[model samples]
Target: MRLSLAIAMAEEKVKEGGKNKMSDKKWFNKGAKAGKVEKREKLLKTYEKAIEVISKYAVTLFIKGFELSELGRHKKALKIYKKIIKLFPQLNVAWFYKGFELSKLGRHKKALKAYEKAIEIDPQYAEAWSNKGVALSELGRHKDALKAHKKAIEIDPKNALAYTNLGELFFKLGNLKKASENVEKALKIESDLVPALNLQGRIKIEEKAYDAASESFKQAMSLDGANPVHFLWDTYTNYLKIGFNLDSEDKKYQEEIATIIRNLEKMNETLSKNQKQEKEMRAYVLYFLGHFYLKSNDILTAKEKLEECIKLKSKSSIKASARELLGNIWNYRIKPPWWRWWLNSPLYRWPKRFGFSILLLLISALLLLHPFIPGWFPLLQINWSLYAFLIVLLIIILFLPNIKRIQIKGIEVELQSPPPYEPVLSPTVMEEIMKEIEAKYTKLE
Candidate 1:
């Protein structure tokens, strides 16, 4: 009996030991899960901290850059923005603003590179694509410009600016139907859009749809008053050219110019006299006033107004028209000093600048290398053979196949299986693909 009792006690202890092992395993699994949760939370906190750290360092730099841009110190803005990009490579806004500042400075190629970098960082960046297209348009790469605009539209279907840009491109290409379609789409999205409305009116005028164009321009004027564009001036004058008592439309044109003159006076008065905007307003008003006088066949008042416009702002587009009109007068237009010869020999209009640059560079470089290379040897001696060799090498590189070639002669081939038949696209299918690619050329942004 004692032996049997002891055996039972041992069995109970073994069972208890097995339960304890299972409990320990469950506790361990729960601890592991808790540890993983803590690690994930820590990671989230670290990411937030990184973002905060970057923001603290980058935001002030961006602000300083913007202030520089506003001050018209574009080079400074570019440098600051570049620094921001280098310091915070993930900051797409810095790249974007840098491109904008470069565009303002007329550095289209550099602006394009900056915008491309921004787009590379964030492919869905609609503004970058639009601005890139603008730079391309300025560079006269219109087909590429259209592609970028369409790309922006693709990323954000609601982007009215992209549609307007596309419309302008189509208009320039003389695809009036497509232009109308796109501009109308932009207007439908934002009825108050003055630029699209104004352009639509211009296109209508070009198409000789007088009433339609007038309505379009009138709507544009209602939204944003008094543009300096000659289109608005010409549209008004054409309306005035309408013969009275003949067509009702003729009276309409005459009345429109009168209304435009009144609106111009209001626009000029509304602008502050102390501001630069005032100068632009005055220049435009005087230019249009001159146009009005010229239309009435009063050459003297036209000459006076145009000369006044010329004196107010040297950079106005109206300055060109003013110079043309004033050509019959004293004609003291600020003609280029080398105006006569510039057309014939543009490169030599100021050849001295280039000569001076070359001489200065040569002198500085020779001075630096005086101990090694004397001035005479540096100035007179030319390495013709080196240049020739470089040119020949470049020619060879251009003519050669771009792909790298490899030889497999030494490698043992598997004695072979039957060659598999590969299905390939036919000529017709390939042609279709080419056309598809051409279509994509319209929307590569």
Candidate 2:
């Protein structure tokens, strides 16, 4: 019986030991699971913090890039944007800014790709779409540009920039009416938008509405005080358009010319110091000022300005224009050759100036010399001298004023043809020129 009890005790001990082993295994598994959960939570927290730090760094870099762009360091800005893109490939704004810098650098094709990437990342990127339209326009894909602008407008109905861009495109296409309508819409949406105001002014100038165009440019100048040179230049040129059409002797003609000079001076003052230092800008200013003075018959002042412009190292085209105007002035200053003096001589007026005196002298000479003259001479035929005198006297009385009138008319006509310089503001030429200027100088929307 003792042996059986011992065996039973051993069996009990074995069962208890098995149960302990199972319990130990369950506790170890539970602890291991808790430790794994803790580790996973810590990893997730670390990941979230890392993302937060990267996002903050990206924002900082973006601001730096924008500041560089504002300073006109587009190449440097491009590098910053590229770095941002490398870090955060999904950032649409980074892509858009990359495109902006590229456009500023005149790489429109590359800019178009960057803008497309931004749009692909975020289809509702209105600014990207609008800028893409500009790239397309630069590429001469007008239809695609139009579609892109329209899409931008559809995406954001209040996109004044898109409207202005659309208007500019229409203007390029020679649809002045449509251009005006769209530009007007842009102005309505944002009354103080400088680009819209400037475009409106350009359209009115095309329509020959000088007064309205002046007002629009003036408004633009006021609103865009920091960059008023363009508006000021436009206003000056608009006055020039009016002045060129006016009779020099008109009471208001000198006043108009004076206004043009004042506007130009204001433009000079408005130019930034760096711009003032630009030989090209100074050449343009001097050339136009000289041109205006030349038109107003201020030969000395015109010669001075033109000479100054010619002496500067400027663009070939501006220098060429200056040289041409200078040549005109030189030709004008030279007295006509002796043979052509009759064109302006008192004798040219004939009967109006000296006919009566000459006829009397002739009659006296004939009376004095009649006795000495040959009898067969035609001068002694049938008292012909008296008839000649009477006819000459009649012509003097009847046609003197008419002759003076004709002389004045001829002077006016000559004055009209004196300025052979083709105006820089010829509609087609000015449109392209101003568009280029705006592209260069105007800030991005």
Candidate 3:
């Protein structure tokens, strides 16, 4: 202790003697200042450590929120998203996710607001713009959706999703020409894109370009493999209906039917090979096969296929559509009523359509004669034979066609058959149908 004091005293004496009039803080004061500086540095380090830790935690939380959202637990997703926003208010993805979840909740206006907020943070956020447009489209604000979609395109011109959305908006607005153009452009830009291909298929179907439409659907199916339930059914129905109509034509009818048989056989083969087909898909295939048989005017095959569709998916929209189609089959197959022969009576087709011509002429002649010859005088002087002719003409012109449209449809088997046994046949036909229940009915193993 004595040596330490002597060294300190020596250091101070040398400093005082050598210094150019410099003063020193007291030793206790110097130590106190040093302690304060050390404390400040420690506080800064602590804050730095805290910020580093927070950044790591934020990323982890963000990922967990996304996972929850993707899993379709929207309430949990919303909670997690809100928490992330609370912790990191500037996160653009969190805002986007919140907007998307709000859209799922059907709060379109709130979704738009959330998307707008995301855009405010990052103006070039193309996905936010596209999502905002989707919400607007869902709300039936096609004009606003168009603008939002355009902005997304401007922000990211290469984004295929934005173009697909724009096409959908145009399609909703009934701007078919524009919708077709935009979706086609999107497909051109990204040929393998699923939604654009689907949209193209939808547009083609609307335009009745059946072959082109079929190709587009196949493309989408190839890309996505298993289509969503409604989409698959709709595409299948369209193909069936179009094929039926086109095959009804005189030329190439046989070829078209042959193609249908080949395709259905191939589809059946694929389904039988343990493919993972959905119930809705199986129902649709069966239903369309029923239609295929119905188009060929095969009652037994059609009946079997229709019943099989009901068996596989007994309680679904497919069942309802099949019922409607089955009813139509009976409706179109009706025979002409007996009253049709008398009503059609040849007069309606030949004279009724142009009978007004003769009446107009007669009225004109009467009017010309009436100025000189009073109306009463003409009736008194008219020959009894001419009066009879006018009477017969009146009966032939007006009443014949009217009688037919009301009572006479046509002459066919449906009119003679026992009350359409479609429903009753279901029980009895179940055994017969069991034979033709294409292996496709078994869900892919």
> What are the per-model numbers of colliding residue pairs?
2, 0, 5
Best by lDDT: 2
lDDT of 3 at 398: 39
Model 3 lDDT, residue 224, Cα: 68
Error at 2, model 1, angstroms: 72
Q: Give per-residue CA lDDT, model 3, range 25-131, as digits (tens).
A: 34223334444546656545444443454455556667776776555466777777787788578988889988877776668898898899999999999989998
Per-residue lDDT of model 1, residues 5-52, tens digit only: 223333333445323333323433433444454665554544444345
lDDT of each prediction vs. the true structure?
A: 0.60, 0.70, 0.62
Off by over 4 Å in 3: 1-80, 229-245, 248-445
Cα distance off (Å), candidate 3, residue 275: 14
> How does each model score on TM-score?
0.53, 0.65, 0.51
Which number leads on TM-score?
Answer: 2
Cα deviation at 115, candidate 1, in Å, is 1.5
The candidate 1 region of ten consecutive residues with least summed lDDT is 436-445
What is the per-residue lDDT of model 2 for residues 207-233, given as tens digits with 9 covering 90 to 100?
Answer: 878778878888887888756445645
lDDT of 3 at 382: 54
